[model samples]
Target: MHYVTSKTLLSSNNGMNLYRGCTHGCIYCDSRSECYNMNHDFEDIEVKQNSAELLKKELLKRPKSMVGTGSMTDPYIPIEKNLKYVRKSLEMIYRYGFGFTCITKSDLVLRDLDLLEKINERSKAVVQMTLTTADDDLCSILEPNVCVTSRRVEVLKTLSEAGIPTVVWLCPILPYINDSHENINGILDFCIESGVHGIICFGMGLTLREGNREYFYKKLDENFPGLREKYVEKFGDSYTVSSPNNRELMKIFKKRTDEKGILNDNDEIFRYLHNFPQDSVQTKLI
Candidate 1:
């Protein structure tokens, strides 16, 4: 990892990424795509050294509070164990009394659970975990380096039990691989059983770009022989690879989450995440 002082930390949308690359090595990682124009190798994380300071400075000026992280890169990467940048930033957000949300696939996030609970108490703190496959072996092939689905489900259970709102990203259900009825239903069962507040699934498909497309196809050939040929034959150069069973499996995902009272629609979930409740704002006003 290399350090650089960033000109700004927060985006116009109130989201911030402390690092510009990830080491979790998810085969379908959109962050690795060329369009982002990350000048460094995806694994050689670009650390925004001034992130905590910049965040604190920016939060002091904001009239309202709602900050999110880990959209482009996993904030809880292994390097966070030594650097604790995300933890320090969280402390700043908590001290400033701003709501916080992070999407990650690492159990390393649990290290800051105490701070997260405090933030939730003061305002709101939502943790989003991505679950793509229920089968552990398949998960290893899909995500490669991060924690498996079962352990992530356990993390969700732990967070839910701690009174921290949790959301699940049931996405990138790779076609010809984990995009099956059983896989989708299995992950949904975990979400229901774990008591997640919401699930964000943008169709049962994965998007591929220049860098990520090559990596994913290589992995497909290595892990599931002949699958790459099938993808080439079907998708060619298309970006979105929707599963053949997308309609049926999506029906299952919607029906299960609706029955369980978990927010299922992507738009509704985004609104819930970004729109701070009037009650919380009123209390802040007081």
Candidate 2:
């Protein structure tokens, strides 16, 4: 973990990545891709030492809107236990009356449940969790370093009970691995039980770019021997690796989400996430 003074925090889209790299060690992490051109090791974790102040600066001048993170990297990695950068930023977001959202796989998010509930009451706070597979054993093999699917589900339920909305990211369905009806159904069942507001799944596949592809193949060889050769023979440098059962699997996904009335359309979900309730804004000062 290293700290550097950053000139800015929020992106043009209003997202802020307080930490640049991650320590959760998910094998299929797209952030490791060379296209990102990260200057240091993926585990080094660049910290914006001034994130709270920087974010406050922007939040003060800007009109109320949603502020998000966890697109480029997970903010609740182990080091966050002590750093508390995410917690600090959330305090500021609440102080300035901006909505909040995040994508993470760790149960540590529950530690901020108090702040999340407070923000939801004042404005909005939506937590988006990644659930790639339902089976804990397979989840261990795929995500490796983070909490399992069951634990994430529990967190989602807890958040929902607190009146904070939650979303699930069902993605990177490794072909020939987790692309089964049983796996999809198991995950959707968890979502329904957790009462998630939406589930974002872009087909039944994962993207494999240059940097992440190599790393993913290495992990596959170590865990599922001969899997790398199979992927190479099939995908062969393609960026989007769709599963053979994409059509069928998507049918199951849509049917389950539709029946439950969960948001299935990506655009609608994103719009919901970004569209702050106009009436929720107020002059809450720190």
On a 0 to 100 scale, what is the lDDT of residue 259 in model 1?
87
Q: Which residue runs of candidate 2 sit more than 4 Å off their true CA positions? A: none
Among all windows of 10 consecutive residues in model 1, the one with the lowest summed lDDT is 277-286
Q: Estimated TM-score per prediction?
A: 0.96, 0.98
**Model 1 agreement with the true structure over 94-158: per-residue lDDT tens digits:** 77777889999999989999999988887888999999998999888788788999999999999
lDDT at position 67, candidate 1: 87
lDDT over C-alpha atoms for residue 93 of model 2 = 89
Clash count, one per candidate: 0, 0
Every candidate's lDDT? 0.87, 0.92
Give the TM-score (vs. native) of candidate 1: 0.96
lDDT of 2: 0.92
Q: Could you give candidate 2's per-residue lDDT for residues 77-194 as a string of tens digits? A: 9999899989998988888898999999999999999999889999999999999999999889888889998999999999989999999999989999999999999999999999
Model 2 TM-score relative to the real fold? 0.98
